[model samples]
Target: LLADDGGHPAVRTGADRLTLTPVAELGLGLGEGGAALTVLPLIQSALLLASAAGPATVYTVDSQDVLADPDTIRA
Candidate 1:
């Protein structure tokens, strides 16, 4: 699964069995200096549970890595 840090389109192919949800769109203004960090773990746990039960694989791409060219990663 490939996820970007918001505003970018996610690449998905019919042959690929994965689901990538970009939580970047959630924004970072839930509280003072983005205190939503407290809920991040819970969100990840829920995603893990759903991924385990489904045929698709779910993974997170760091914001920095997501900005890199996919071709470069392949190399």
Candidate 2:
């Protein structure tokens, strides 16, 4: 997942997957830690946000569904 961090399109593709897990999983944190990611309310959230402790948000996107769809991200 790439974010321009500016006012630009944020297109996503199923050609690949980007995942962020707990920081503790890296064996750096003594106890436990996470990336502390915050995401908007969108289908992409399904990839960036999920937990057995939260509301179920299941969504699947076809490879072409998001591929370079600037309009989808621009909105």
Candidate 3:
């Protein structure tokens, strides 16, 4: 799905996949699916913010670790 992004349009058709481009990029002649993708409006957190700044960190943990010691994980 595509929606206005600061006047430009963006679409995320799959996980870890997103694009901010012009309408002509749709290549409608390729197939009907491409044409339909432009119809729906999409709003997702995965979109980038041009004004955002600051340090950030991400962590991945196993469910077992949280089950074993929830307090430490919270800290």
Highest lDDT scorer: 1
At residue 9, what lDDT does model 2 achieve?
20
- Per-residue CA lDDT of model 2 for 1-75, tens digit only, reads 322222112312321234422222222222221212222234245645664357755656555657857244321
Judging by lDDT, tell me the better candidate of 1 and 3: 1
Query: Which 10-residue window of candidate 2 scores lowest in summed lDDT?
Result: 3-12
Pick out the ten consecutive residues of candidate 3 with the lowest summed lDDT: 2-11
TM-score: model 2 vs. ground truth = 0.17
Candidate 1 lDDT (Cα, 0 to 1):
0.47
Quote the lDDT for 68 in model 1: 75
The model with the greatest TM-score is 1
For model 2, state the Cα shift of residue 53 in Å.
Answer: 8.4
Candidate 3 lDDT over 20-75, as tens digits, reads: 44333444443435444553432222233422644455666668887887654431
**What ranking emerges by lDDT with the best candidate at the front?**
1, 3, 2
lDDT of 1 by residue, 26-63 (tens): 54333342424545776789889998888755565566
- Evaluate candidate 1 by giving its C-alpha RMSD to the native, one decimal: 17.2
Error of 3 at 23 (Å): 10
Q: Estimate each model's TM-score.
A: 0.29, 0.17, 0.24
